[model samples]
Target: MKDPVDILSALADPTRLGAIRLLWDGEEHCVCELMRKLGASQSRMSRHMATLKVAGLVIDRRDAQWVRYRRNPALSPAVAAVVDAALALPVTEKAEEIAA
Candidate 1:
């Protein structure tokens, strides 16, 4: 698992946090899907997913020209708990506005 601080910091950004939320269901999401849902550009979404990967919060694989990502399935119980807690936090009004 990544350092607690790194995991927390990785999730501090709204984009990354939103990615995590989307992956929380344990479904692999392609970069295009993430971009469409998050309303981010390809480069920007890739950058955010890279950050999550570095934090050990997500894993990715190439699918033709696109990359797919999902939550790390091998997370330690403690790490999973932390992620659950973070996901439990309510979305902020600003984030809601962005989604709208």
Candidate 2:
């Protein structure tokens, strides 16, 4: 079986962690919202998002031309625990600025 720590490690990236934090706070967000919030390019955000999806930390839904992401509530207990821990961290300045 794949190690859950590996999944957590994938989320440890600042960019990916920011994405997850945004989803946790907002429940769901679109690519554009994330791009603006993180001040990251579409390609960069997409790559991070794809990693999160592959790690099972987030899930995607399509709405017309937009793709929305949310924390995967059904994630494995270990993965969920990691997410919980991450959410408890001090929100980054960029995240806070965007959240305001």
Candidate 3:
């Protein structure tokens, strides 16, 4: 398991938070999809995904020429609760707002 601080630190970034939300449904999303939704450049989206991967909040697999990411399946109950709670909050602005 990753250190809690490292995981929390990764979540502290709004860009990462947004990406996490995108994967909250447990569905895998291609890097291009995330970029399109967030109106971000490929480099920026990939950078944040890399951060989530390091923190163990997400997993990535190469799908042909694309990379797809999904929320980590082995989250501790407490960590899962935190993620759920965060996602439950009403979005005053789309998280993608920060992604751009």
Considering every candidate listed, which one attains the maximal TM-score? 1
Evaluated against the true structure, the overall lDDT of model 2 is: 0.80
Instruction: Give all candidates' CA lDDT scores.
Output: 0.89, 0.80, 0.84
TM-score, model 2 to reference: 0.79
Ranked candidates (TM-score, high to low)? 1, 3, 2
Worst 10 residues of 1 by lDDT: 91-100
Compose the digit string of candidate 1's lDDT tens values, residues 5-45: 98999888888888898999999999999998888999999
By the lDDT metric, which is better: model 1 or model 3? 1
User: Estimated TM-score per prediction?
Assistant: 0.95, 0.79, 0.85
Best model per lDDT: 1
lDDT of 3 at 69: 98
Report the lDDT tens digits of candidate 3 across residue range 1-100: 6888888888777777888888999999999988887777899889889988998889999999899999999988888887788777776465647755
Q: Assess candidate 3 and give its TM-score to the true structure.
A: 0.85
